[model samples]
Target: MRFLFIVQGEGRGHMTQAIAFYHLLRSQGHEVCGIIVGKSKRREIPDFFSREIKAPIHLVDSPNFVADKKQKKILLGKTIRKNALMAPTFWKSLKTIHQVVESRNPDVILNFYDLLGGLYNFLFRPNSRFWVIGHQYLIHHPEFIFAKGKPWDKFLFQLNTHLTALGAVQVLALSFLPKNDLINSKFRVVPPLLRKEVRKLEVKTEDFFLAYMVNPGYGEEVLAFAKSNPLVKIKAYWDKKSAKPIEYPLPNLSFHRVNDQTFLQDMAACKGLACTAGFESVCEAMYLSKPVLMIPVAGQYEQACNALDGEASGAGIASNSFDFSLLEKAEKKDTKVSFQFHQWVDSWPNILSELIVSAEQESGVKNPDGEFDSSPVFG
Candidate 1:
């Protein structure tokens, strides 16, 4: 079977998921014909995608969030306005998606929760079967707890999830903690898609912490912490524009641009991961049996939910700020959760096979070549 991956190129999370699934499909004798990633002005298609995925990647303009002056919080109004102004570009990108799908003639299309993927499906109504995967879909689960006192934020975040999952036949909801499937809905609770490199790291008990910040503002908090504790060392990764290699901001702190290998190596050696509550990084930290101090990005309800869920999953404690004091107290995290996590991670091939086949049959689509991955969606 042939597949095409449509990814949201906002951060390393979606792209990393795509890389993992691409390898999984190939290992199962399926071909990934092409990849289409939605691009944002603030982000660059990371080197890892091309260096690792081994697919012809197509990048096109898509809607993205606009951050505030501090680059910490999402400016919802400004974001909508900016993307509204780029309406013409997005429309063209939609058409481009149609052309790619048509030319690739994939057996199935997988969406990594890309907004353009949902919009294209909703508007273009292409005949190809589509499956949507992301931790965001877990929001729809009955047992899924959301952050309180932010009904409006939760509503908007869910709206975005629905938009990205608009026409999906199967919604693969990645979970921080396993829950029962959504009864009578096109949702399945699946393990987080952790990269192979992360799973294979040789972890060491180091003294310094690994800090990953999607927003640059969090670095100041880390820097402030470092200033107070002059002896403690911090290695932080940020997507700061035009940043030099070694950004020596404070005596005990250094900031590096987002580099996959460097980040993974640091993850192996760090005492704990002090970062935002993005699903992917937390999962990676857990797989390495490293504790985390998660600070959810401001106004992102999804991250708030992730922070809470990650805590429940025994990833580490959650904080509203980058306070390294918490790291010292919680340095020796338990390894018991890792056994269950690895068990869940190992089950993806069979689970996804079942879901893909189920989606194809439910959509009433069959291949012209009489080839179908009729394997059971579950063992």
Candidate 2:
């Protein structure tokens, strides 16, 4: 079978998911014909992704949305305005994507939350089956846990769901939340899709904590924490947008630009993680038996929920600020989330493979795997 994937390029998470899925499909004897990446001006596609991926990659102008730094708010107006300005370009990119898909004639199209995929599905209406795969799809599930906040926040959350639901035939939601949270939804709650590197790694807990954050303001706070902790060595990664790598030698601190292998290696070697409460990284850390010190980005609800859930699962501790006391407390706590995670990871591959097969079959494509040939939708 042939597969085409459209990935959102807003962050490394989606790209990592794509890479993992690509390997899984190839391992199952399927060919990935093409990869369409939605590019954001603010982000450059990492060198590792370009060099590591096996299939042909194409860039497209797709809508990119981000949260505001100070308040951790969505900045809906700004997001809509920016994405609206790209409408013409997005449409043109859709034409290019359609042409590529038509030429490739993939048996299935898997989208990693790229708005361009929604646009493509809206325009061409391809006969090939389509599946939307990502952690973001969890937002649409009715049982999805909502952050404690204002009513307007809830409204905005609903709006986000409506926009993301456009043109998706199937939604795969990744969450640590209970199965009840995923019940009665059009989507399926699957285990977080971890990268093969993370899945295969052997974790060792060393002295230093591994920290990474993409947002600038919160990153500064993390740096501040490292500066004060002279006894504890800290290794961090950030996109500082500087031509030269900035090194702040505080006797116990180090920083590097985003490097996949280095980051994974650091995670494996670290005692724990001290970073923003992003789902992908948190999942990776938990899988590696590393406790996390989760600093929820100031106004982002998703990160807030992630922090709460992380704490609830005993995977990590949550803090509104980079409090040294909280960090100490988390460090002193026994890191036992490892035992709970193995079962989750063991079940995920089968869940994802089955979903992909079902989506393909629904679109009239034959499934090569008899084990997953039936259209089974498990909650």
Candidate 3:
């Protein structure tokens, strides 16, 4: 079967998931014909994604959050106003998506939580089997735990989740641990889509701590903390386009541009990790048996939920700030929990293969080898 991917380009998590899924599909003898990624003016498609996906990538104008001057907190009012002003551009993007879908005519359109993908399906009503993949979709699960308070934030988060899954036939909710499938619903709980590189890494403990911050503004907090504790060594990565590849302002503190190989190598050997509460990195750390300090970007409700969820799953402790000291103080994850999480992650191949076959069968689509049957297959 042929597949098309539509990914949200806001952060590293979604793109990483796309890359992992792309490889997974190819391994199963499916072809990824094309990819349409939601893009904003502030960010560029990471080189690693382009190299790994190895498919035609088209970027289109899409809604993105407006961060403060320091790029620390997301300003809700300003974000809504800014995207509202970009209505025309986003409309053009939707048309582009429709054009691609009509031209490619793939058996499946896998949406990685991009708003435009969902919008295009809703308005254009394409023929392909639509499936939504993201951790945010887990919010509707009855047993899911939410962060305390912030009613408005929770509402907006759910609203976005709903919009991204407008016409989805199957919603794959990526989880840290296994859970029962949502009965009589379109939701299925699945493990994280970690890339092959992450799974092959040789884990170890080193002296220096590692950090990954999506909003470069959080670097200020890390820098301040580094200065206060000059004896502690730190290696951090960010997507600051203007910064040099590697900068060492202090003997014990250094910053590097986000490079996939270097980041994974560092992660494998680091003593601990301090990163935003994005699902991908936390899961990576958990799989590597490294403790983490997760700080959700302010005003990103999905990330807030991730922090709570990560804490619950023994990934690490969540914090409102990038305080390495807190990570140092926290207890290490239980060996049993680490073993269980690893076992859960390793089960992705079987779980995902069943899901793909079920989705294709439900849509009455032929396999890549041209095998087709109308009889429904039970999952």
| Most TM-score-accurate candidate | 3
Write one digit per residue (lDDT tens) for candidate 2, span 1-379: 8889988887688888888778777777789999999887766889888877888999988887656754234565787787788788888998999999989999778888776776577667776666777766766666556678556656755555445445565677777644544454446777777778887787777877778775645556766777777787888887555524547657677777888988999999987788778778888887887778888765556667777777876667888776544655564334444656667766766765776566555655546873333232321
- Give the whole-model CA lDDT for all candidates, comma-separated: 0.84, 0.72, 0.87
Best by lDDT: 3
Give the residue spans of candidate 1 off by over 4 A.
Answer: 359-379
lDDT of 1: 0.84
Tens-digit lDDT string for candidate 1 (158-186): 88888887767677889976788866456
Candidate 1 at residue 147, lDDT? 90
TM-score of 2: 0.86
Top-down TM-score ranking: 3, 1, 2
User: How big is the positional error of residue 193 in model 1, measured in Å on the Cα after superposition?
Assistant: 0.6
True-structure lDDT of candidate 2? 0.72
TM-score of each: 0.93, 0.86, 0.94
In angstroms, the error of model 2 at 227 is 3.0
What is the TM-score of candidate 1?
0.93
lDDT by residue (1-379, candidate 3, tens digit) is 8899999999899999999999998888889999999986666688999999888999998899898888888888898898999899899999999889899999888999998878887888777878889998888788788876888888878888888887787788999999998774567899999999998999888899999989889999999999999988999999887789999988999999899999999999998999999999999999888899999999888888899999988888999998999878867668898889889888877976887778656666766777653221111
Q: What is the Å distance of residue 278 in model 3 from its true position?
A: 0.6
Q: Evaluate residue 284 in candidate 2 and report its C-alpha lDDT on the 0 to 100 scale.
A: 85
